[model samples]
Target: MGWFGRKRDPQDANEMLRQYNEAEAARLAGLSSGSNLAPTTVSASFSSAEFAVEDVFTITGRGQVVTGTVASGVIRVGDRIVVLRDGADVGSSEITGIEMFRKKATEAAAGTLAGLLLRGRVDVARGDVIRTSASA
Candidate 1:
């Protein structure tokens, strides 16, 4: 974002990017105050690093499981949660917590490839796209 270099603060710049594109927030995603989202496609990954909070990164995941399964701790792309169990079609009674990477996710579009999950869950199968509930 050299063009937006003057935006100042990576978080602010990210917010500016969100204001520009203006993607819809997940109705059930439970966003925080003063949170804005912008949906755009780009490659992202995450890793452990010794840096300040300003240092940001991305993570991606893919899957083909039932939509309902995602809510049942399926660990989709851009989620920040821990993997307590590693099994397919696991029962909700066994799984615990909504695993995710970031508190506020931006641009969750359901498509062949998903971009942005901090930890990047390995279980997510291929060809699963988390899309916005909007018309193109």
Candidate 2:
């Protein structure tokens, strides 16, 4: 847990990457062996959630509520996430709730402006990037 609430292991990231690579290779394998197919390769992975924190505040009974834009990937309520500042990992927290336009949501996707209620003690500021512990 390192001064923060939780710490992520590099192995987890490696496992996700491995799975993505295997899936991509399998998909491409079929196309290349076909009689009339352009042996094309498409790669994708649930790398992480990139959010540019725009505001940070604490709600009386809800802990810290962070409003930001999901720059990439998707974030769901109950996902474990980390706060990053200046390209360094700071702390980890779980998403307690998600809200958009005053309506509760189960998930928020890239390019959406959403507010995430985080449980745990966090010291986040504007411009910080919130990334997920696992692929989202």
Best by TM-score: 2
lDDT of 2 by residue, 1-136 (tens): 5788798656786688679868856764565567475321112246777777889998897699999777678888888988888767789889999998789999999767789999988879987888888634
lDDT comparing candidate 2 with the true structure: 0.78
Best by lDDT: 2
Candidate 2 is scored at a TM of 0.65
Q: How does candidate 1 fare on TM-score?
A: 0.17
Which stretches in model 2 have alpha-carbon errors above 4 Å?
1-45
What tens-digit string does per-residue lDDT give for candidate 1 at 1-136? 5775656545686677576444423432334343474222222222210100111232234321222112211233333322212222211111112222334333322221122333222333322222211111
In the predicted model 2, the residue pairs found to clash are none
